[model samples]
Target chain A: MTIRILTEGELRSCVDIDREAMETVASGFRGLGEGRAVLPPILRLDVEDANGEMDVKTAYVPGLDSFALKVSTGFFDNHKLGLPSLSGMMTLISAHTGRVEAVLLDNGYLTDVRTALAGAIAADTLARRDAKVAGIFGTGLQARLQLRALALVRPIERALIWGRDPEKAAACAQEMAASLGIPVEACAEGSAVCAEADILVTTTPARSPILQAEWLRPGQHVTAMGSDAEGKNEVDPQALARAERLVVDRVSQCARLGELHYALEAGLVEETQAVELGDILVGKAEGRCSDEEITFCDLTGTGVQDTAIALFAHCRAQARGLGAAIEA
Target chain B: MTIRILTEGELRSCVDIDREAMETVASGFRGLGEGRAVLPPILRLDVEDANGEMDVKTAYVPGLDSFALKVSTGFFDNHKLGLPSLSGMMTLISAHTGRVEAVLLDNGYLTDVRTALAGAIAADTLARRDAKVAGIFGTGLQARLQLRALALVRPIERALIWGRDPEKAAACAQEMAASLGIPVEACAEGSAVCAEADILVTTTPARSPILQAEWLRPGQHVTAMGSDAEGKNEVDPQALARAERLVVDRVSQCARLGELHYALEAGLVEETQAVELGDILVGKAEGRCSDEEITFCDLTGTGVQDTAIALFAHCRAQARGLGAAIEA
Candidate 1:
């Protein structure tokens, strides 16, 4: 009956953007595809006065003993007050007794890691096997974590960074080159990112298309993990139509907020053309038919990822004796 | 940032079934009626294996500094193992920064208090000014709380308790008589309880109508607070058709899961016939027009009440220095 409370620093000590995390998320997707999971639509509350939005996401995977209910808040104006714009906590409930067992005060750390791992999962499932070049569009924490995650699954040896702010992208490039021990360059033209990189990830918060359909080439795999909202579009709608294969985290969600939403709106690509990452992971649908075929994946975050990552981090924290267990 | 954790005992010490608590929940409804509150649709996760359901409810009221995000779980089979069927916790988030301020581990104590008070609000507004006898249909905790709450707002000299189990109802009646210092009687006939009581509250789990419309009379007000699922009904739909005034916690929710749902499905009442309790609380809609009017208010509950009650408890707990604050 005691509930464990784990902090962000403690979770960061155990859970990382690694292979274990990838498979943890991959297992949730497998359950989703195999039809053994229950994922409810996200509950979102928006406050116009504070420019804030709080999203509640959760899912139940049968094999797992407990489910994670995560409350994530994003107050866009927090930066002006010297506070991080995003913060959240997760409550893990026992499936058998329906009692809460733990409170994860990760403050969005688990979310950041899980999101990065999902990007890696999409790339590992859809990208060319011998793909060595990695490129990302955002110069932020996700930009660094995604490439680092890609290196864990793909044979990524060189990387390119693209950003609206060239200085930030250049700084990101230098950091990635030193940390990853690979050749990382800040590209001046966006088309070069679409053309040269075997694996391209758009991590920006662009409202309009940053990656164009005309710039894409054969054998290229695109993973757009940048933004998710009704208005967020990183790649052109036509870009999805240009790819030989299109994949999504969830077709239903992506059809509403992901790249496929715009594609379906413009009559460029039908929703049926896109296969979910879960279906591919479970072999229920086809992934890459050939290395020569272009692939594109839109990454809109899911509740199952949160549940899987939270449970994984909770287990690690418990094993390491890193959290406080108050018998309240 | 720090999160204060308050347990059930601490919450009960400060928050109670009283006038102050009534006003706190009343203010939330007023804000909701004034069109300043933001309530998101509830998110639910069902686990068929365990016969469990996890419900997440939240709301944002502009004037309240923090809004509450509540996670409630119900596992029906837990009683076999000597556990309560329902358990939950509420997290209060700062509306200014969207930061976690406290976690109220009330374990559904706050929900019970708020729910009972909502029944009082309905009775106080719609019941006759001369209401002296309060009757409830269930023999559980709510059966007692509703009468206690009604006593706060009305001049009640006696109370009636009705249930499927006559022995349990008689025991509850004796216990209530000793506690409330009122003449309490457990009646075998549900029709007798309906005919004698001026204010009636249904808190049962019965699937069929326990209160018949043929027995209802003028100058009587009914508060049906039991069972919120699709198939549960404690009062007949025809009873609503007979009522002079009809009120609901929220029309959208009532249309889907409340007594109004059943009434609408039976084509006995129109959706527009039911006015929100908030509207009456804020003077946006009319309540009881005459002493001879038969009023029925359906209380399916709302997120605003959670936000209000949690905030009230947090403020009192802070004033009394009652919780453990962890700087995680």
Candidate 2:
């Protein structure tokens, strides 16, 4: 019994997830919403030590016959030790046989990619067809991935970047302009960027409201990707309350971990008020009702996304014959 | 961020799982019974395809700062395909950071060893110290491990083996006699071996009773390591009713996936009737009461054992400079 083990580099060489893979994952979202599969509860562990804090989360999605177990650690104090605050590895296992097929040592790269891809999927289904302007808050890895994914899914003419660090925001704009082939400019304030864009993406790890309800324009699609943990909020509760359509990757997950957590806590929304992203993907619910309707997609990430990406990677790796073979 | 990948051969060379490491794991069991640690639920998947039937069970133990995810598949139909079905890997992750620290491609060998060691721990705490005769049922990998573990924890002077295959049982007896320097014989029937032994170990995959109540004697301790899944049983429920005391690895797990599962279902024993094996190890409960008590220890494997062995393997691999290093 030999199980093929694919390492980080090997996986990178073999996996070519372009627009096609993103579409497949989007389809999986629909399957998930229809109850054709099972996405179990996410398992979490919080570790506190002299080196700071780290949260480990594992998600299991049964339908894809695969589960992606990711270990992400945030060592806030690691900067002093000349190490990044975050590091991780994702193991893709066969749900059918429980054989670990690949070890993705991408730190947090895949998380960023899958998360942004989910946002892109939401944009594809919910954003206005001619969505021209994109607003991005926070000049982080997530911000970059969101921009790249949005480019793949929408016709973005320009991007507005806003961050706490003016220099970093400027650098992000310049980098995106060169790498993503888009015209991007750093805004003076978060609200300035939020008000001018047709699509908005919040990637800040903020505890307080950064984007207010008044700043959001009608028909503008907003993706709240940050504020996934408890006590974390990027968008104000008023924004969620005012949105005409409240869509989420997973209702239960969003209620606990996404921006919806705050909305529910503030009595602004209930479970019945929310529609799953999958429902809209499958045309079970309306995405953007009118040109002037406010819309929001709260994505906390799901195990199904992990499973889809893993399956995609596995198939691609096998096709390319990239991984090393080991006898079991 | 670099992660180490340990192959089976490399891991075997690095892991110094002699008596000392086993003793440490034995000591950790005390904390398990005290409720200071948690062994989460095991996830199982059953696949019956052209390749035969495969049962994959993953056990998660959070206290060891790790989880043991093991996969075992039965390839009874693999003869036609010229393949073996019962093969899989165990992944050990660091609970603190959720980093997959090591992957053991042991094909269930480690699980067998850890399970047997756990049985040894139970026998050490529960079995009479001066027991001279040991009886084992089913000639398999688990049976060998159980006998080896029993010898490690008791003063066993001889071993009696029983299996459906007379040739396999005779071979097992000869192997044990040569390796352990103990008097060994293959019994014609299960009752014959059970009646003559001071300590009994059953490691079969039978769905019906293999051991009878009438065969058990006073001052005898029986360790049933089989009957881990739903419809698997080896010892009679009446035997459990006759036992003076019953010990289990985990109360909840035993009630769901061990010999206790049947006993509880039969209404012969309740959850409270069973004591954790860890409790006995920590002296929280009595083991044997005089020389006339019939004791039973239901041995369903736990995730803690996986974590212990994985950690042991990781440390040893690091020390010996084994396994390939890949960038995370």
Candidate 3:
């Protein structure tokens, strides 16, 4: 048997946060919404001594010839050792023969790309058509990607950034300004950014809520993509209660590990009140009912997205003949 | 990051079913017995179209520097395509860093070695000291390995083989006779094999009992290693009730998917009556107490065994510099 190996650079060269990639990911959401995909719960492993954890996510979509199974690592103390805090790889297996087709050593790149695209999908379906200002939390890799991704869907003219470190936030703002050719500024508090922007995306790994309910204004859409694990929350539970509409990537997962977990814990949200982004994308559920409605979407990330992004990466890399192939 | 890829031939050249290999797998049992290993439940996915299923098992032992995550495939229809019914690979990651250190593309070779070694460990700990004859059920790769592994510790001078097909059983017996320098014969009845042999092993994909309770004679020991999934049983549940001592690889796992599941359903076994193979290995529980006592062990396999065997293979392959390393 022959298996292909795609390095991070090869994958980066083939896939980008563009329209084709967005549509590829949108099909994944549609598959999940239509119940044509088999997405299992995350298999998690914890290495207590190193203060690191690994999450294994996978999904099988019959429409695709291959499915992606991802292993994502979070070593919180790796930065002290001059290594990045996040590193991982994805494996694609043939849906027909049950053999591994390729291994993508993306080191969390595909995860970042797919995560950013999910934010754009959420905003495109829920945000007002004329929304121009964006607010971003966390000055990490995702912070920059989220802003760029938003610009692709909405008329994002400028953005406000908030982070724990003021200098890092300012640096991120300057970097985004140069990349997007839009005015960007660092905000001292998340509340200020939340109240002023038309679209707000929280990308921080905060254990406590960063945005409050009172800060949520009408004609605004919020997407929380950072809370993919337990004990991680970005928006206040009261905010979920106050929003005119609440949506999630997957109701079962969000209620267990995302911002919706806290909202459910506080009895501020009902299980039935939540709608899925997949359903909204396929027009099975309403997204933005009115321009004055406050919309909230909590993304815990799903295996369907991984399968979509990995399959897309494979096709692109094969077309370019960019990855290494080995016989087994 | 650098990942070493070891082909099946490279791995086979370095490791075998020797005493050192058994001890390596033994340490895994010790870790689990002492409550120092973190083993998560298997993540399983089913592909209906291919008539196949995938099992992902992993474990972290604090005493080991590296842990193994294994993905195994069982495609029931692969033989019709001139391929093996089972295939898989294992990945070893640093316990301290949670990084993918190496991928052993053994294509189920490592699993086979570890599984056979588990059978040896069970027989060595539970069989009579002077046992000289063995009875093997099934005519698969595992049936042969179980016999070869049993001889490493016992005075096995002769063996009886049984299978659904008489020609395959005869061929297996001839093969074992040539390799082991012992008298091996094909038996027509599983009951006759069970009643005569000092040690018995069942290694078939049987959905019903193959060995009856009345056939279980005193001074005979049975090791059933084929019932790793639900709806597979080799020994009658009544045999479990008749045996003087009942052991399992892992109590909770066996209770859910092994022979113990059927026994528990039939009210022939009690949850508290079962003892673990690890506890037996560590002297925490008693093994065969007398030559007249009948001992039976049900092995459904464990992730700890994978970690132990994979770490051993990685060390040997690295020492000999037998694998290809890729920098990412």
In model 3, pairs of residues that clash are none
Model 1 preserves the real interface contacts to a fraction of 0.69
The per-candidate count of clashes, in order, stands at 0, 1, 0
Q: Which digits, one per residue and each the tens of the lDDT, describe model 2 over residues A1-328?
A: 3455666677666553369778767866877777664555654434343232333334444346666655556656666667667766566655555556666666665666678889889888888888989999889988988988898888899999999899999999999999878799999898899778999999989999888888988889999998777878899888999899999998888898889988899899887889999888877888897888889999888766766776777778778876666654
Which is the leading candidate under TM-score? 1
Q: What is the lDDT of residue B179 in candidate 2?
A: 82
> Could you give candidate 2's per-residue lDDT for residues B160-266 as a string of tens digits?
99998999999999998998898999999998998789899999999999898889988899999988878899999988889998999888888888899888889
- DockQ-based ranking, best first? 1, 3, 2
For every candidate structure, what is the RMSD over all alpha carbons to the true structure, in angstroms? 1.1, 3.9, 1.3
Q: In terms of docking quality, how is candidate 3 classified? A: medium
Q: Give the interface RMSD values of the models in order.
A: 1.0, 5.2, 1.2
For candidate 2, the TM-score is 0.85
User: Model 1: per-residue lDDT, tens digit, B28-70?
Assistant: 9998899889988888899889999988889898888999999
* Cα lDDT tens digits for candidate 3, B1-328: 8888887888999989999999999999989888878888888878777787888888888979988888888888888888887878888888777778888878889999999999999999999999999999998999999999999889999999999899999999999999999999999988778767999999999999988889889988999999998889888999999888999999999998898999999999898899998888788999999999999999998999999999999999989988888887
Q: Candidate 3, which segments miss by more than 4 Å at Cα?
A: none
Candidate 1, position B34, lDDT? 93
Q: Write the per-residue lDDT of candidate 3 for residues A1-328, one digit (tens) a residue.
A: 8888888888988999998998899899999888888887888888887888888888887778888888888888887888887888888888776777888888899999999999999999899999999999899999999899999999899899999999999999999999999999999998889878999999999999888889989999999999999899888999999888899999999999999999999998898999999999888888888999999999999999999999999999989998777776
